[model samples]
Target: METELDIEEESDDAVLGSYEEPVRLVDDAAAEILILWATNQPVVWKQNFFVRQTSLSFSLDACGQIFTIIQSPSAMVKPGVTGAVLWDSGVVLAKFLEHAVDTKRLHLLGKKVVELGSGCGLVGCVAALLGASVILTDLPDRLKLLKKNVDANVGIPVTTRGYVKVLELTWGDELDPHFINPFPDFVVGSDVIYSEDAVVDLLQTLSQLSGSHTTIFLAGELRNEAVLEFFLEAALEEFQIGCIDQKRWHPEYRSCRVALFVLVKKSLSCM
Candidate 1:
């Protein structure tokens, strides 16, 4: 007989698998997820949220990093859609949360960091709290939630630290030209590579905001060969790409592909 723990393990596999392939679950699948998450919400601060959670770099107030989260709104898709972006609160963001960003680990403190498609502003929030000047950004609708989170968290001093702010970042749309003299020192994007068409836009947008001193870290949850191949094609021109780490979450969801790169100049502004 299968125990409840076994059933939950199976459910985790099923949930992770739903990313790469469609799971023909009942019409109430979404509701079930909501209920499960709601039920598990309180347990986050208890003793069980440390096991697989959302894909955000949520800061845990206690000892050791939090290994779990419940950023459900960050993963909600645009109705009936499936694939990497579906429920992908940006796995790269989650990876950042799973892995800690130390101040001396390459001395990233006091630097300017910007995270694109920051579904729930996880990395940016952590970065800001960790002493870096971070801008948490995403699409307009997503930015609304991002703003709410920033407002709720910012200026509140993280035990002794500060908070991050939400910024509007539409792919292919560059920031104002006035701040070009002092561009961000670091740029981060996680679990953002999926669609084939958006590749060009994402790269082009990155190129504009980056400069010679800009160090960019990109994290992607590879869904297929095509997505990875297309991303490399689009991104190689403006940055020197190299893999840094790979950590598995589940069989269905590929381990997050973390790459570190230094931003160079582009020949022309595509944005």
Candidate 2:
């Protein structure tokens, strides 16, 4: 008893249900070259490939002010070159900080903030924009690009407020007088927890930089459960740890595979 209209409707429904989104394969190297050309930045030829700049935009608030960061291209397996590029966890943490400030959950206005492993300084730039006096730190080789990005994005000091500085910090090294004399009110790290061999050194550095009143925020990709567990196990000795709820972050930035943690020095009473 089915009419032609009924049959056509059924066919349409089946077609729609079976439809799949198309996937586009991209040549990463070629795309980097194109991006470099469009941005008018000089390109370097290395090992039969082009090294170029990558531009990223981060929103500072609901008012639509954005921070732009320029960074060199990076390779996943390249030795000693990870800090030249941007990473997803950095973007997520930047967005999370913006969200937190917008909601008044965490106040950064006029606070002293330090960012560890500030690869391209995206998170630190965003923090500076949010009114925190920020110190961006990384290895010696990485400081050049980090400073470039910070200078380009943050610009000159504004009326003695929201200043940004770049410093070299090697994990487990002797504590510098500047880092120890005035502990940062806040310590932040994005995607700095991947290396198992460096965890102890990192913890030592963090302990040296943090105090009872200092708050620490760490955002990292949950790629290896055992590595993360090892960090948490070691960190528990000094810090009281809690994970930020993923639902509280901007929906666009929410990643089930990425986690943000808030840590505070454990009080003797609580320990």
Candidate 3:
């Protein structure tokens, strides 16, 4: 039986610390320019829904172009909600995807991909930009902001080979057939294993969404070692796991505070 755990709320400062990089917004007549410490390049925020003070922008350099993702910092304060802000793990994982493709270690072109707990949709957007059809999923409440970011980044230049769509996915709920009919070639997530209560359900959902041939990539902040260990222990029961070496991460976007892993369902014959 699954049990609920009482998770401590993260303080405002703790939440803001996720983005260790310095950030400043510059005002422009037509749009706001976000200057991120890592990528000194200014990301221009469109005036549509991105003009609010709560909106923040970050960039990912991938597929020979830059992808800008908009996040809502204000949304993070909602009770038990962490999906509104862009976390460092998301950045690390997204950049790792780019590095893997560039190094010919991974192939995503024309493949189907899914992102679990796709907060801010950074990793999924990067996957789409890398030519993979991607579905970005999270809780129903998270879809609003998730879709907003996807719409702003995924098809901007119309040069990507694959497309991206957003959907509501509550971990452990009975998944819609559309999500598993064609088992995704790759499942990616970042900062998803923060709470113990969600670990079991997350593993359950992962098991259902993956096939023997599917590969799962996850990254998380190292703030909670016990929860992460618990997740890994539980996940091993259904999948083969491996830690991705930091050496293989994107050259410029690496972090000691984030850990990345790759998992695959164990073949039934082997099991």
Candidate 4:
């Protein structure tokens, strides 16, 4: 007797539980970048045909800060070196985090945070600025650039106010207890949900890093709906998923192509 809409609502409730409300935290400029990427436009990149090394600057209005990221030229980036470049979703997420903290929608002060697939370490740096101890992780080869950006923006061996550390984390590998014993209060990722082959591993890593009190924020460009759907299906098994409303952020950042999800550990009963 359930209508399609009823069934859909029930399914969403089952997967999302009490966190069904959308929290807006994206801007229109960020939204436009995602749209361009979805349409195969080169708005974020410098060269049309090839990737080019470039320096880019992002402004955090809430804190009146600017981050300069050095992007490796596409020519120098070999296979499996995608993390050398900054992506639009990363920028969007960084901006959203800044907006969230400014508006008091999310608290990062005195919290431990981890960023997965932290290309260029922009989001991690922003987290540090917002008063969260941050661990930025990517593949081993990508650590150099990631560390450079983090150090350049956040300084080395940061103090108790907020610290930033770079680590090599290959998805699906056994998590190190030393790095995650207490579990971070918040986990963040940007443009990480691309490969169909990597989705399972990515979800596994997320599950391992999350505790009952942990919340995860993931922002990804909608390149392939099927791939995104696959990730959501797998993620639902371990976490309660909520979509953050575009309206919660600056009007300039809302995008039809860029999506943000907030994930929390599912209750034991639900599990």
Candidate 5:
């Protein structure tokens, strides 16, 4: 029988992803800062009860180099602005990719990857750094920030092995020819399943983009059991699903708050 957390276990780092030495921001409002490990880059924010942050940065260890991804944060008060802010699920997924590639467990070299809901573009950037030609997609409104980050981190000096591009992709809409002509080797998303109403649309897009050979990896925060369960039930009909236990994740990056999954076409898995 298929299970959500079905992957085999592997040893991983013990610490939650480490941070570098704290660096204070220029403004007096700067209170607490968390630095990414390896590169002592600081992520600073105001000292308020509800911190209002402008930008967030993370340093990841991958490709024998430290890669930094900078993100612009948007307030939730805005009607449709969740994509601009960084989320824990995205971080966990990005770090997992880094660790998996670094450890020689998941080979991304020369593969084509598509990241759904590429908010802040973290996972997509890391994939490029690991040698996967990647397309980062989201709504048209989210493209500007996604493109900016892709150009900054996945360009020449930082990622020469692979390439990254940004395109607008809505959940239920028709996919562009680029996504269908050469189906992606892997499709990925972090926190893409949040609402019950969007599940069918997301499944539609996933079905159209994947082939028998395509693999899908998704990470999400377990915010609502009903929504997640609904997605899982709907997805299982078309794909073979397996869950990656926290033990199999990057030691320091694994979290009970987030869940990671692996999916493959049912036809391929049944063979």
Candidate 6:
């Protein structure tokens, strides 16, 4: 059964999501416009569509080079709103933790990794170039832009230490066959567990992707009390949780408190 809100939402999205080819003006200037995926629905990939209000910047970081996407007041990927995005929810924090597995870091030895909800694929981009096999996952709608980000940044193939692969994975949907590894050795996500409706699907995906030796790294801004409660309950099955780190994204940045959580999957022996 669907609620009235859901019904109306679907209707609006369908009506708004009509697309045609890019139109060219009399001069050489041209503009590309596409359907909004599902109008009024939350944007599946924030980086894909070119909106007038935003710009992407490549920033140098202590860990390595990562892209910074800045959102502005006039930017309207949607209607009447300004959005602040640090990194894709699962990607920004994953970038913070990359030292462990990155060859340049000299700490972690494993190179295989995956990031869910990779909005701009910054973390995966860095990892793949640093000599690890990295898989970047997000919705199909975003893959076009995600691929663009990869192409825009990495000029040479990262054959020495890393490889980047983009995958389309919606929360709760069945896992794609691209990953033959069965369970990933390490799963890192950031800011991914915010939506209450999407929590169960997220947990289900995590459970299916982790093993006893697997390390699951998560980072998020606490949206509200309900979000925290949902996480406590959803990921309780396989993970022996530990609150590893917490901090603000920027010193003066308000409403942007970030926390890092490390959960080790406990198999029968550990239990």
Index of the highest-TM-score prediction: 4
Stretches > 4 Å off in candidate 3: 1-55, 156-161, 268-271
Taking all chains together, the TM-score of candidate 4 against the true structure is 0.78
State in Å the error of residue 43, model 5: 25
**Candidate 2: 10-residue stretch with minimal lDDT:** 14-23
Residues 1-271, candidate 3: write the lDDT tens digits. Answer: 2111111245211101111111121112112111121232212322222113355876656767777777788776788888887777888888888888887777888888889999888888888888888989999888988888888877643345666778899999998987887888888999889788999889999889886457778887666446766776677666655556577789887765666777666553243
Quote the lDDT for 18 in model 3.
Answer: 11
Which residue pairs does candidate 1 place in steric collision?
158-161
Q: Write the per-residue lDDT of candidate 1 for residues 1-271, one digit (tens) a residue.
A: 3111111234322211101211222123234334334543423333212323335334434124342223543354565222212223344443343343431223345666778777655556656655667777776666655665555554444433333556667788757653245787677776667687778888887877776456566655433456656666556554434333223222232322222222333332222
Q: After superposition, how far is residue 3 of candidate 6 from its true place, in Å?
A: 46
Residue 133 in candidate 3, Cα distance off native in Å: 0.6
Ranking the candidates on TM-score from highest down gives: 4, 3, 5, 2, 6, 1
Error in Å for residue 226 of model 2: 1.5
lDDT values for all models: 0.48, 0.66, 0.69, 0.69, 0.69, 0.50
Off by over 4 Å in 4: 1-62, 75-77, 157-159, 268-271
Estimate TM-scores for all models: 0.60, 0.74, 0.77, 0.78, 0.76, 0.64
lDDT over C-alpha atoms for residue 121 of model 5: 86
Instruction: List candidate 5 segments past 4 Å from native.
Output: 1-66, 156-161
Q: Show where candidate 6 strays beyond 4 Å.
A: 1-54, 62-95, 98-110, 180-182, 246-256, 268-271
